[model samples]
Each structure stands twice: as C-alpha cells, then as structure tokens.
Target: MKIEEVRQHVTTPLTAPAFAPVVPRFTDREYLNIVYRTDADALRAVVPEPLQVEEPLVRFEVMKMGDVSGYGPYTESGQAIEVSFDGERGEYLHAMYLDNFPATASGREVSAYPKTAGSPKLYVDNGVLVGTLDYGTLRVATATMGYKHHALDVREAERQITVPTFMLKTIPGYDGAPRVQELVRTEITDVVVKEAYTAPARLQLFQHVLAPLADLPVLEVVSASHIRTDLTLAPVKPVFDYLKGVRS
Candidate 1:
C-alpha cells in the first residue's frame, strides 16, 4: 500500500487486527447487573486517586450483545465500583473479561479498557437469567437473577446509563516497565432503553490466581437489574495523567 493509503487505515499497520478499523457499537444488549456491598478498605486500596468511593458498593455486570456494528456478537462480564470524580457520581470499571479476541484487542488498544480473553456466557435457563465467566476449565464467577421481575423506570435507567465511566489504562514500555498510564473516562450517548427490569439475584466469585473476582468479597447482596438497551460506545478521554507526576 502507498503511504497515502496507509494514513487512512484505522488500526496500526503490520499488527494483527481482530475487529474492523472503526469502533463497534452494540444494539439490544441484554444486561444483568448485580450490586453488592463490599469491604471499604479493599475498595479504597484499589481505586485510583481523583476518584472517590461513593459507597462500599460494587456492581458486577454480565452483558450479552445481540448485534454489533462491526463485530458480530459477544458476551462480557466485569466489575465496577460506585465512585465519584469531581463530585460527579459514576462507575469506575475495575476489570472485564470476554470471549471475543477482536473485541478484546480493540478495546484494550483503542479505548484502554482492561479487556482480557476468557469464556463468558449469559443465557436464560428455565425461567432464570444466568451469567458465568470461566478461565479455561475453571469457573471464576457466576450470577443469576430473576427474569424480568419488575419493570424498570425508563427515565431513571437512562440517566444511570449516561453516567461517566472511569478506567485505568496502562501500556507497558519496551523494557516491560510502565509506559502509558492514564485515568480514562468514557460516556455513552444516544441511549435508547427498550426494556428494563428489577429482580432478585445471587452471585458467587471463586478464588483464582489469574481471575481474582473474590478480592472484593460480596459482603451483602443489594439489588439486581436486567436491561435491554441500544447505545454507542463513545470515544475515551483521559482525565488524569498518571505519568506526569513521575520524577524524571
């Protein structure tokens, strides 16, 4: 390809590109979010600076994307904590695991999302909605919730979905040292909530060396929600530069 043609490419040249050059958007996403209380100290230790903990609560989410703009479909599971940045309450995404390689690679390289490859499944069995994440043959986390127990308020759900999301984006240097480290923020726009519901739920996180979901122990089950929404994943912005404070 000519140099002028290379400039039009979306992803890095000569690298293995999984998804398309553009960012993928999801539609009619089935979501199961389980909110729970956890130890305040453990949360304080992991949560980065500039983002304060709103409460000792965390939300574990298992999402099944029905259709995507670029990539086809995938299932993802992760944890986010209730946090505030500059007095604005939002979620700080801790970690995420998905089965799609292209989605994982693009998410990490483009948006700085902490995406790793794993087996994550969300499905309805009998009358209950079940979500599970596994590393190889070992199950790491599992969650279940009642299927559409009560209708969710559309306005409130839309407001909650638009909240700012923070993530720790890190890329190692050539020598395996810290290279790029930033506190990235993302917000979803053009949200259209088709259906939502509140329900009873249960969660179980097993101890594992690689997947440590149990690090933030589930102290108490708070609430659960199942939602179907269509939204676009907006571009990420860095709110805090972690490397700026390093002494040269």
Candidate 2:
C-alpha cells in the first residue's frame, strides 16, 4: 500500500506515512514507577508545557492473512506487543516542571510514557547494514541465524530448515523481580519460502541496551497457519490513557 493510504485513517502521533491499518487497531498501557532522585535547582532549570490530565488514547491493530480455496483446514499465527512509550515521560516531565512547578519545587512524581520498537528491512552484508524488501509490515523480522550450536552467515541462513526462535524470559520462578534472559530454542515446520529478502536495519535497533533481554535468541518457527481472530468488546480505556497523566 502507498504510504499516504496507510496513514490516512490513523491519528496516532507515532505513525509515519508508510503503513496504515487493515483492521481496528488496539493499544495497551500500564504505569511503571522509576525510582530516582531529582534536584530542586535542577528541576527549576527546566520548565514545561501546561499539564492536561486527559489526552486521546489509541491503539493500532495490524494482521496478515491468506486463504487457499482448495484447502481443507487453515493455518495461521497471531502475536501482539504492548504499544507503549518511554520518551513521552521525558517530554512530559520537562514540560510540567518548567511550567507548573510550585515556587519551592522539591521533588518529582512517579512517571512513565509510551515505548515502541519497530522492525525495518535489514541484513548485514560485509559487516555493514544494508536494506532489503519490507517484510509484511513487521517492525522486526525473525531471520534464521546460527543453527544448532553453529553460527552461520546471513546468506547461509535459509539452507537450514530447522531454525530457532529467540525469546527473552523473566526468570521463570522469580517474583515480580527484574531479570531477563535471551535464549534460542525452536525448529521450523512445513513451509514455503515465497519471499526472501535480507533486512539490514535490525542491526541498529538491536543494541547493548537490549543485550540483557532476548537479542537474536533462536526460536523454533514452524509454517504457521493463518490467524483465527477472536473478537470481543474493547474496554472503555486502555493502557495509554492512564499513562498520559503520569508525571514524568
């Protein structure tokens, strides 16, 4: 789809002109407290926009599907990540303190904002990132990398049918504690390689910051069947709504 067509129906601030929704989009949000210390003089140094307790909240929905007329049974897979923010908190904090702080601004309030990650076409050639075909609107594409204890080059990836899906997990038994691990575990299933393009942009987003989380950890990806959507009434307010008011 043309970029403008994709963005026409979207009012989301984070949207670009490239892609648009094929279905009703959804967003989920939650507040996370970041413990820190703020200086009286430091906060005074920066001012902010007038605070508005209410702001429009929106979530984006996207799905891909295909059907074979002669087929007996259908197959598909669906996955959705929480649409959120981190930068909004920073911006909101900057605005409010500068514009709304009391004469003796002494401290800070718990704050949070939207955090989103996208996948762009990417693959590394000669150790340099290079562009490739866009893969089905996916912000990130899962590429078959090293196999069964063997690290393979990007070119040699398709040769291995059995691939791993990487996953970042919270220490399974640990309480709401903070810890994450990346591990490669999975093999491919009955499949079709109709489109193949090496995506290079992934290199930039996968940084040292996410090293503690799942980085190219392998996943056992089978030929997934077409997704079967389960529809239900959405809630009055999703996550981002509450986030808009959080003091950053």
Candidate 3:
C-alpha cells in the first residue's frame, strides 16, 4: 500500500479493521443506574487533579445495548464518580467493563475510554431488575432493584444521563515514556427517553484483585433509576493536556 493509503487506514490491523467508521447510535438502550455514597478519601485517591469531588458519590451503571449502529447487542457495567471541573459539575469515568471486543477496542483506541473486557449482564429475572458483573467466572458486583415501581420524570432522567463525562487518556511512547496524557470530556446528546422509573435498590460489590470496585464501599444508596432511551454519544474533546503543560 502507498504511504497515503497507510495513513488513511491505520486504525487497528493494517489489513482489516474490527469496526466500521460510523458514529455509534443506540436504539432502546436501557440503563440501571444506582447512585450511592462512598468514602470521600477513596474518591480523592482515584479522581485526578483539577477535578474536585464535592460529594462522595458514585454511579454504578449497567447498560443494555439493544441495537447499535456498528456493534450488536451487548451489556456494559461500570462506575462514575461525581466530580466538578472548573466550576462545572460532571462525572469522572472510573472504570468500564463489557463483553464486546470491537466496542471495547474502539472505545479504548479511538475515544480513550477506560474500558476492559469482562462479562456483564443486565436482565429482568422474575419481576426484579438484576445486573451482575463477573470476571473470569467470579462474581464481582451485583445489583438488584424493583422493576419500574414508580414512574420517574423523563426530563430528570435525561438530565442525569446527559451530564458531562470526563476521562483521563494516557498513552506511553515506544521507549516507555509518557507520550500522550490529557483530560477528555464528552456528553450523550440526541436522546429520546422512552421510559423512566424509580425503584428501591441495593448494591453489593465484592473484593476482586482485578476489578476493585469494592474499594469504594457503598455507604448509602442515594437513588436508583431505570431508564430506556435512544441516544448517540458525542465525540470527545480534550480539556487539559498534562504533558503539554509540563513541556512548557
């Protein structure tokens, strides 16, 4: 291939790419979000600087992707910590685990998402909404909630999911030195909330050497929401470049 062709198709494998060049759009994406209070010190230790943690809150989410543009149906589970940047309220993505290889590759390579490969399932068992995450056949996290017990305001659900999300992107050079390090932010826009509800919920996180979600022990279950929507994720933009600042 010519140099120009190589430059244009340098995504993953030089011969074949896993996913197409298309913006991800989800249809009937369901979310089970449980916002709980955790230890403030734990939040401080994980959350990066320039981001302040006002409340010791973490949102544990299990997402069921019904239909996506490029990738097919998959389930994802992760945690986001409540944080603020430059006086703007947002959530910092701590970790994400899913089962899809293409989605995981694109998330980490293209968007710099903190994604890892794991087994996560979100389904309705009997009349209860159940979400579980396991690593290598070992259960790490489990959450249960009443299935649509009370109706929730659609606007509130939209607001909750549309909050600005921040993530740290880091890449090392061939010599094992820091090459790219920055803080990026993104939001989910173009959403149509199909259903939203509230329910009594409980979370249980087990101690895992790999998936250390239990590091932030659940102090109190502040709120839980069951929402279904069709949305598209916006492209991420870098807000702070740590390496660039250090070079100057």
Candidate 4:
C-alpha cells in the first residue's frame, strides 16, 4: 500500500487487521463485581504514582459480553484497585484477561486496556453465579455469588459502571527505552441498566507467576453487585505522562 493509504490505517497488518476501528457497544453486558479489602502495602506496590489507595480496596470483575459491535461475544475477568486521582475516586485497572483474540488484540493495541489471552467463563451453575479464570491449565481466580438475591438501585449500579477508570499505557522504543508512558482515563457512558442485584459473594485467588492476582490477598468482602446493562466503552485520553511528568 502507498504511504497515504498507510497513514489512513488505524492498526497494523493493512491487509487484514486483527480488529476494526469501530467503537464497541456492548448489549446485555453482564457484570459480577466483588469488592474486597486487601493489604494496604500490596495496593501501594501495584498501583502507580498519581493514584492513591484510599482504603486498600480492590474490585474483582467478571464481564460476560453478549453482543459487541466489533468483538461479537466474549467473557472477561480482571481486577481493579479502588484509587483516587486528583481527589476524585476511581478505579485503576490492574490487568484484564479474556478469551477473544480480536478483542484482546484491539484492546491492547488501540486502547489502554491491559489485555491478555486467558480462559474466562461466566455462567449460572447449580443455582449460583460462577465466574472463573484460568491461565493455561492452572486456575487463577474463582468467584461465586448468589444469583440475584436482592434488588439493587439502578442508579447505584449505574454509578458503579460509570466510575472513572485509570490505566497505565506503556510502549517501548525500538532501542529498548521508554517511548510512550501515560496514565490514561476513561469511563463507560450511554448506559441502560436492564437489571441489577446484590448478593453474598466469595472470591478465591490462586498463585500463578504470570497471573499474580493472589498478591493482593483478599481480606474481607466489602460488597458485591450483579449488573446487566447496555453500554459503550469510551475512548481513553492521557491524563498524566510518566516520562514527561505532565499531561500528554
């Protein structure tokens, strides 16, 4: 392709890109979020600067995406630390693991999601909502909750979904140096909460070298929410630059 055509491309592999540039809209997106308290020092070690841990809280989430604009359907599970940036409460996404390749590729390449390939499943099993994540043949995380035991306020569930999200986006230079290092922020929008509920939940994290979610160590289960919504994933904008020490 010509240089002009190359400039128009949004991602690599001009012949057949891994994912399209369409903004993904998730329909019937189901989420099981378990917020728990962890060690304060563990939170500090993983959460980067400019984001402060207020109460040593972490949210473990399992998302079952029904229909997506570009990615079709996939199940994703990850952990986010409850943090504050600029005095505003938000979540700093630590890692995301999913089963879809295109979604994983596009999420990491075009957006700030720390995406990786893994086996994650979310389903109802024997009258309980279960979410599990496995790296290779080893189980990394498992969460179980009562299936929609009590109704939750739609506005509160919306707030949980719309909370500002922060992530560190890093790109390495060709010469083995830092090229792009940014703290990006984004939030979900245009949400239509179909249903939401609260339930008793329990989580277990196993040790794995690559997926070290157990490092946080769940101390106490603060709360849990099961929300089903139709929403859009908003684009990310760099709020702070680690290399330059200012907004990029």
lDDT of each: 0.87, 0.22, 0.93, 0.94
In terms of lDDT, the poorest run of 10 residues in model 3 is: 239-248
TM-score of each: 0.93, 0.20, 0.97, 0.98
Which 10 consecutive positions of candidate 4 have the poorest summed lDDT? 8-17
Q: What clash count goes with each model? A: 0, 41, 0, 0
For candidate 3, what's the RMSD? 1.5
> What tens digits encode model 1's per-residue C-alpha lDDT throughout 10-87?
576445545688756789888888999999999999898878986999999998999987777889999999999877
What order do you get sorting by TM-score, best first? 4, 3, 1, 2
After TM-score superposition, what is the CA distance of residue 208 in candidate 3 from its true location, in Å?
0.5
Please give the lDDT score at residue 196 for candidate 3.
99
Per-residue lDDT of candidate 3, residues 101-167 (tens digit):
9899889878978999899999999989999999889999999999999999999999999999999
Ordering by lDDT: 4, 3, 1, 2
Candidate 3 error regions (>4 Å): 246-248
Which consecutive 10 residues in model 1 have the weakest lDDT in total?
A: 9-18
lDDT of 1 at 110: 85
Q: Please report how far candidate 2 places residue 19 from its true position, in Å.
A: 20
Residues 1-248, candidate 2, lDDT per residue (tens digit)?
58876555433333441222232221110101111223323332322222121211111111222332122112111121111133222112121111112111211111111112322232334544232212234222222221122223423333322222211222333575434222212223334333222221121112234221123221222211111122211211112221243322
- Candidate 3 or 1, higher lDDT: 3
